[model samples]
Target: MNRKEANQPSPISRRLFFSYAGTSALTATLVLSGCKDDESGMPVDMGVDLGSGDIGVLNYAYALEQLEAAFYTQVIQTKYSGITAEEEQILTDLRDHEVAHRDFFKAALGSAAIANLEVDFSKVDFTNRTSVLSTAKTFEDLGVSAYNGAGQLLTDPNLLLIAGKIVSVEARHAAAIRSLINPKSADFSGDDVVDTNGLDGQMLPDKVLMLASPFVKTKINASNLPTP
Candidate 1:
């Protein structure tokens, strides 16, 4: 190979990305399996109960990841009108990240994972860049807040560490979408999402699910999730 070719970084395939992304959480799953609470008794009359304790939190994160992955997949498949090549690449990367995250949680949760969520994106106009990007911002912001809010509820150190890592990625996604919406502006880390304390906003499980209801067809019962 030429010197330039030898210096190039290896391209990462989706399969390899999934394996890398899921390895830590998958290992945590094995460690947690022996000590996690039994979920069979969780109430499901209202809908799918996220379960309880750390499992519930994992399910919650998994559900949101599923929604994001589905949205980005659609965005890439349809490609909003006037989408630049750079925008296409960014959106494609976001789609892959979200899918990897979804698969990671699913693999981590194993039999404890929630069912695949059915999302309704009828409100999103794929032909319109404004509509597509605005919707992406909403989902991305919500995901960041969801992770932040749920972080305190995690009891296991390993799970909490994993959640922290995922939330940071979610924050990056949120910032990227915000920048796309308002380039050269401070909207990416605007005061609306970042408070006076310089910390990102957070929303509890119930509140997060309520805000996410419109996009999700499947009913989620976060009633069983742990509180403060």
Candidate 2:
């Protein structure tokens, strides 16, 4: 789809989108079907379902990794003017990691994987070091939290193992971004993100989607994902 067409706002919020869809008495079969919101609701352009069960969770991770990959790809494409050599190298590594993670999910899901998601980076100024690092920090932190929160929803032991490995990598990325922003700061395990018990922050799928909505061009219905 064209940029304008892809970027248009969806009529329904992610929270209500799949929740209502599930209750519609429609066929339980999951597929990449699109539908519009009812006339009474906000005119959200409906996107495909993330599907149900473990595959849905994989799609969710894939979607977020896609965003991270896209963001880092953009950052490297147009390096910020004052970016240090260390910053460039680390950002390049981050880009590579995100791309690998994205591809890994795609490979694992095969036919079940979601389509390439459109990402909107209009709010970011790629040429500005501060802006880029700040945004990177935000994404890395969000990614770690997303995986932590979704861990309980994964039924497959293998999937949980894979997720654990990926979350550690994302945590390292977050620390690196934090260090870039503040050279004197502790890189990993930030006080803001970790509690007195030293546990990292966590966020539910709905909350993650809400925070992630702006960057994604394609609407996602994640009501089918497992919750606590």
Of the candidates shown, which would achieve the greatest lDDT relative to the real structure?
A: 1
What is the C-alpha lDDT profile of model 2 across 1-228, one tens digit per residue? 121121223233223333322322223345764566777876565576778777788789989999998999899889999888888989988887787777766656667778889899998899999889989988999999999998988876666777888899999999888988888867567788999898999998899989988888788888778778
| Candidate 1 accuracy as lDDT | 0.80
- Per-residue lDDT tens digits of candidate 1, residues 130-199? 9999999999999999999999998777678778888999999999999999999989999989999999
**All candidates' lDDT scores?**
0.80, 0.79
CA lDDT for candidate 2: 0.79
Candidate 2 clash pair list: 10-44, 10-45, 11-43, 11-44, 11-45, 12-44
How much is 228 displaced in model 1, in angstroms? 0.6
What's model 1's TM-score? 0.82
TM-score of each: 0.82, 0.83
**For all candidates, what are the clash counts?**
0, 6
